[model samples]
Target chain A: MINRKSAAALIIGDEILSGKTLDTNTQTLAKHLVRMGVTLQKTETIRDSVDIISEAVKRLSESHDMVFTSGGIGPTLDDLTYEGVAKAFGLNLLKHEATIARMHEIQPNLVLNEARLRMATLPEKCDAIWTGGLWVPLVCVHNVYVLPGIPRLFSSMIESIPSDHFGDVPPRERKILWCDLAEGDLAATLDKAAKEYDVAIGSYPATNNDSKKLYRTMVTVEGDEADIVIAAAEQLKGALNARYGTV
Target chain B: MINRKSAAALIIGDEILSGKTLDTNTQTLAKHLVRMGVTLQKTETIRDSVDIISEAVKRLSESHDMVFTSGGIGPTLDDLTYEGVAKAFGLNLLKHEATIARMHEIQPNLVLNEARLRMATLPEKCDAIWTGGLWVPLVCVHNVYVLPGIPRLFSSMIESIPSDHFGDVPPRERKILWCDLAEGDLAATLDKAAKEYDVAIGSYPATNNDSKKLYRTMVTVEGDEADIVIAAAEQLKGALNARYGTV
Candidate 1:
């Protein structure tokens, strides 16, 4: 049977919305989720607001099997991931002694002031997935995994997660074919093939930035059945070539 | 008065969600919106599914002053933006002669097959915003603006958008200060300053990939009142310097 697990990403940070920082976490998470046979269905980027965070988490969690949240987990005033997630689940925010211990281990000489200690507070009934030494563990509350927004930290934490966390299934097979013709000219064939085949097909009309080719159409087919997906791709290529000549 | 006409982006594409393509449209739009004094409140990346597209467009259109959508407007089987937005507004899809004429102008030598004609279909009761010749005009349905997914095309379309569309206000003033100290150590002070001043402050802890400094904290203050925003920045800087010498 095909794996049906679906995931969504909630990327929270004022910096991203202000265009001060570029978000790579969504793309990173999507790649990993796909590797685990889970489809990343949607991603939302919002500011560091508690109300927005809580509402998005609640809604996404109800619809998806897993929801990953990146950012607002730091020890700054704007970091409200713990509080917002707790409010969403109706849980109290409590200090995690283990997290505090890990923090001390990371920076033994640093003072554990109120601000530094803030990172220790997490939603009640949450579990921490410790990746390795000196790094903060990823927090898991219900179906949502709270991750740091820092690209390096987020990537490392995700790397440490067991590949089995998202379950397993037959890997999806995809094949892409390129045609020089306008995608509009091939839309009817694509529409017909999509209905007849069991594969999901996508047609992209792209303009090369530096290449001599002004326009190229990319047709992609993805499905669990490799043979069927490949067949669909080949059929699409044939139709495009038949009408507009191959690129 | 401050311009509070905020907007949100709906980036629709399977390539983005499947980790096949990186989405830069969100950042591009955010920067442009900020320059025009329109805050980009949120952005969502969803699949090419008609149901998902319609729901997101309808919901965001109701909440935001303006909603911009990129992708899924092409002439492919998966290109459901026209159909989706129409469904959301309870409008019928109709063939527009102007759009058809423009398509022909863009490719005068090509035959207008059923697939090619698909590009002429659009939602009724909508107005077109033509940027220039030979390009498909951006469609405006209610508060939503549908645009192409191609980066070059999207950038050009956005740039061609009337500057007066978002309304004008006193340009926001921003000041960023970098500190070598851990952001956690300065959270409390940052929080206090944000409440005391009529400015928004954000603390970002970043790790330098190629610099000697392992970590640097970025403190940003932004507001319509230039004096208040700058004062907040200076105050925060003084507090940080008092605690840890400036970098």
Candidate 2:
């Protein structure tokens, strides 16, 4: 049996907490995960403190099907994500010879300072996915995938991760149409449509300058099959239109 | 005594959970609060659910010295922040006559939909701080300031919030410079610096392409006072430099 339930993103870095960096990774991952039929339940940002990072890693790893941690894997003293992650799984940070060699290959002229080489350290028994660069190394520990915090690198590394390795869940296509209708007014109709189609319907309202304001309701219907989503969306649109006219 | 310690940000939106919009409000507010000498301890994101919104409002209002809320105060069905906040405080959501009059003055040709008019409603006993378009009315609930989620609007509203509202506490800053040192190698020193300063000092390492494999270390000292921070930074920098010499 395949676990098809939960996912989480643990963003690690002082830059996040200090507000020096805005976390785009959480949103990006959340959207992507949802598209992949994975429910992203929570996203947390913890400082680069080892205790906090370790605790977060342990808790999230145990609870979620997969955990993606971004940031704090750099060659800096403040970069404690690797060590914290290693400690979380009770693994020693051993130098992975292949990773070091890859690092050298990418930047042959690169200095091999102990700090720079630290990027090659991985938890024992962990699978290191080398999206190699001067930035942090992306590695997978248990169900957790650690990537760099830099938005560009983070996104690229995430894309490089094979979706099959995470799980073989069917992709779900979700779409939304907005309307100007009071939630209370549309609640019963939406409920009927939801029950009829066995789909979830969310009704939200948006007000406007006219006393006859519009509700920007998002009627999202999702399923493994594109036809199912489209059919549900059409039903909702028709019901809403019948009541409020063209939105 | 005025407690000038804790601050919080309330992210109000259904779109956030629906995955329609990525929240930048929390990050922006957190950064501002940190720089203003206020410790941003918690952030809450709630949907347009009235009960949840009200509960969050009451709880967070009582907990933090300053609270910044973004989204859901717009003229839309999903925008129920004003009503929820009013209910949370057990106050009436009365249309501020002045605000209504102002709205009328600004958009005389504008149709006054009940939903749009709802935007002018204010919780009794709260102060209103107008930000952005003359047509929109933004307000504050106790220490909680309600702002729109549109990046520009949110930022503009933030400007109206008095900077000195949280009072003054000096921020500590420390800088560290080390060459050819890995974080693990300097763990003991880093721990000592943190203990000595009775604050947080972060270590960041950067790699180079030198023959000696040089790495630059960034030690950040954070405290409530400048002197203690500078002293700790100087001590750590001196020790590291003496051990490794300048790169």
Candidate 3:
């Protein structure tokens, strides 16, 4: 199966930076990308200023194969993601006829006012992917996927993306071992296993839900090969003397 | 009262980027910073690589008056934040006697293993804020505050910091106006108030919690001064002709 291997997320909003809003888009995008075997390397949350947005989009787009931006794609004055993206590519913001046509197709009685028409103005060099019968198409400019800030819409747009649109990936696997010892106590054991197995292992101090389950540290072993990942997890489980293999 | 005017958060972790953990420290920092009239300009969540951590910390520190980092400050092999910070300033990682002493003070019979002792090794030049009767000091190197990844510990460490520790403040006030109209419909009104009143205004589409309250769009008005924020909210409240001021 074709999949994107490396990705980055850029969350654009003043509300998020201002603490007026909590961004769930990063996690949503993360879960979806992980399922596609895409490793989300970094996420940058910045204000809605066009200057800030353009600079960040340019920087992130250059580093990762696929870049996903959430928020500030609406019709408001604060919605400057389209302009920022256009600026990032040194393009012009032009009214998109397809988006306008799709808007009418979705809502026959829609009043195409100045504000509503503002949504049609997008980067000159972008393609719009209309999916799931939604009027607002997923705007693609280069490697960046410009999505709306709304949780429901953003998630649906991501879900509708075809896998081939990405790059490539090997089927990855994850295994978690629950250990009662403190993270420090399991550190040396984790280090030895990680060095020997040559797999991605992470030790996390448990909290909230994990704590409720009487779990202390959750050691995760992951790799592109299932056999290797499993072998590493087993080694760590035995080395740490962990009883519960809770992957 | 002194308060830092601008802040940035650097979240260092593999679990967060790998979608294994959701980061709540940014919001916790934002809320606290906003209360002190400090604008959290940006938040960057990256992997637990030393190079990535060092580069991000250095860049963010230069941009903001205060920088806070969450995660990657443990005893495991993956814990590389301290090394990253020291590398950022070209400083050496040295053992701190004060941290070791405090650890003994907290737990007299504790074993200072190589793993646990790793926590005591901080940057060469930094102040250790011993607070909340906790052995682990809040390591402050330059403008960056290196904090633990655990949500509870991170929150308590932040709470323990005195207000005077910051630069300056003028008591921020926030007011939200809940309207039963779409965000697009309220766009013009929000824009006008923002331009006219010279206050920070944000328009958010109602989420799960706000939707349960029968609210559609939440327009927030905030400023360092209370009177201007209220006046702007009042103007927007009247201009939008919304009867419900939810804040």
Candidate 4:
């Protein structure tokens, strides 16, 4: 493989934990990081409570190269990510003038009430990076990047972060071996090949989408080194003795 | 509010971390626990590693009343939940005759290879709960329940667990106030009503599904008692001065 910087994601929202909303941010961040050649080490989904957010931020930021936090940054009552992140770093929240200016630019005649002003409040020593002609700023405190819960805003903000910000990792090559053999029957061969190869080999059973199994089992062998990855997959395919025949 | 037990979920799989798969298990468990009147407090997603699983199980199980783990229990090489659970409890995995019998019943004349036998081998203190005519067991080690990652099997296995297993909690009532006001405009009012009433009130801005906004903002007032829940929603509606009027 190649040397790659690792990152973790912290998703903050009560809607996710209560089953009221499905979390798409983690997946978005994951796929984005993959394209940037950064490995997403871990992800956590938690409620919007300040204590929980603060603790998770501290924990995740300590372990990984950087941490990306999604949600809980709106002007609503439940939005407490700024306060939580500030508390995590022993800093304070300050109303950022740039954020208010951007907000006024978007709404033109926005009423600068306490409710609207809450969006301008950010952690001390943090940078409010604006983008996409949207008023919402992607707040960065140290290595922790705080983002909004809205999917549109989250996706654009993540995309705007420069690829070099995560250092550089060359893209990896991947190959797949498909077979009619069920996961149980295909397990032993995969185990053997994985031990002999330096690549990541994963076996996935075909899932029933709407109770209909539409595909056969698939085994993936992937690594930054293309030659070894391809060789590993080729070896597995050649040695396979499929009771149900190869797919 | 009525008394309720809280639970945490630990989801394990490399595919999830690598963005190769989207996780629906956390949502499934969250919705299921909601039906049982149990509160799901937190959810964590991590790579498929023995040490990571073992540590997460210990930490989550200690903090919450119970914990549910999804994935890494298959017969594949990467399946490591049993080993992790055993390490967490200082127990050893032992081969179970019942699981082998079930495997035979499902795929008669099945070979009991090491890979297949791995499915029958479980933690010493764990209880293998069978359901839905599937050979895969819902292995429970004390307050931690390990389940398969596949959505279809995860859904069915979670349903088979008895309600009383989580202890009894009367159902909670929920009421909602829909409005055309944007989230920034609705924030202050929600903050006021949530503080006044002893209820969990959450404000959600409308999302753009396929880049099209299909609905307006929604505010939920929920608690164990119906009287106060409805009162909270109604009070917010009466006090609401919607610039766009209430939806």
**lDDT of the candidates, in the order given:** 0.82, 0.68, 0.84, 0.83
lDDT of 1 by residue, A1-247 (tens): 4856889999999888878777888888877776778889999999898999999999999999999999998887788988899999999999899988887787788788888777888998898999776457688988899999888888888877776678757558878776776687777888899899998988777654524354467777789888898788778877776322222
lDDT (tens digit, per residue) of candidate 4 on A90-203: 998999988888888887987888888998989977887778788888888888999888898899999888777777677667776666777878787888888898888888
Compute the lDDT of residue B96 as modeled in candidate 1.
89
Instruction: Kindly list the per-residue Cα lDDT of model 4 for residues B36-66, writing each as its tens digit.
Output: 8888999999888899989989888889988
Best by lDDT: 3
Candidate 4: which docking quality band?
medium
TM per model? 0.92, 0.69, 0.95, 0.93
Per-residue alpha-carbon lDDT of candidate 1 for residues B81-178, written as tens digits (9 for 90 to 100): 99999999999999988888887777688777877666678999788888775457789999999998888888888888787777856457888777
lDDT value for model 2: 0.68
Ten contiguous residues with the weakest lDDT in model 3 chain B: B205-214
- Each model's iRMS: 3.1, 6.6, 1.5, 2.5
lDDT (tens digit, per residue) of candidate 3 on B6-109: 88999999888777777888888888887776788899999989999999999999988889999988899899999999999999999999999988989898
Ranking by DockQ: 3, 4, 1, 2
Q: Best by TM-score, which number?
A: 3
DockQ of each: 0.57, 0.16, 0.70, 0.60
- TM-scores for chain B, listed for all candidates: 0.89, 0.81, 0.92, 0.92
RMSD of each: 3.5, 7.6, 2.3, 3.2
lDDT of 2 by residue, A181-233 (tens): 55435555665766777554544444232133344454456556677667888
